[model samples]
Target: MEKPVHHFSELFEQLGLASDPDSIERFIQRNAPLPETMPLAEAPCWNEGQAEFLKEAVDEDADWAEVVDHLDASMHKAQ
Candidate 1:
């Protein structure tokens, strides 16, 4: 079984992001918790494709869904 992702940096890699520490930290610092009302799929941090990926993951409950959910929850909690 695939190991679960446990950190933002890991999630970024899983999602094919550039997961360098500085980039990851910048991403976190900039996005943190999206506005309480914004949906994860609509968070401004995402480009069009990234947002679509997140939306489909959540909508289809794809394998990445769990990681996406984790990220969504974490971001929301950061608020």
Candidate 2:
């Protein structure tokens, strides 16, 4: 499925960041491309179950805070 494109305001709201163009640009520049290598020694592996869970999470129509919280909890549990 094609990912829906969002405005900067949407991204800022989702991230709980300031909805300013400069701030958004800085964030984009700082974290646009994630590194291919794992940053930690014991990074969580992405299996089929996790992938399905994430796909469901992303595709759900829910509040941004709830979605972020769910993702954070999942990552924390995986660690």
In terms of lDDT, which candidate is strongest? Answer: 1
- The number of clashing residue pairs in each candidate reads 0, 0
For 1-79, candidate 1 gives per-residue lDDT tens digits of 8745456666698667878889876766778777889899898878898899889988987777887887787677763
User: Which candidate comes out best when scored by TM-score?
Assistant: 1
lDDT of candidate 2 over 2-56, digit per residue (tens): 4565554664564456668787556545443333443211234334554444445
For candidate 2, the per-residue lDDT at 76 reads 42
Q: lDDT of all the models against the reference?
A: 0.78, 0.45
Positional deviation of residue 45's Cα in model 1 after best superposition, in angstroms: 1.2
Worst 10 residues of 1 by lDDT: 2-11
Candidate 2 weakest lDDT stretch, 10 residues:
34-43
Q: Give candidate 2's root-mean-square deviation (CA, Å).
A: 11.0
RMSD of 1: 2.9
lDDT of 2 at 8: 41
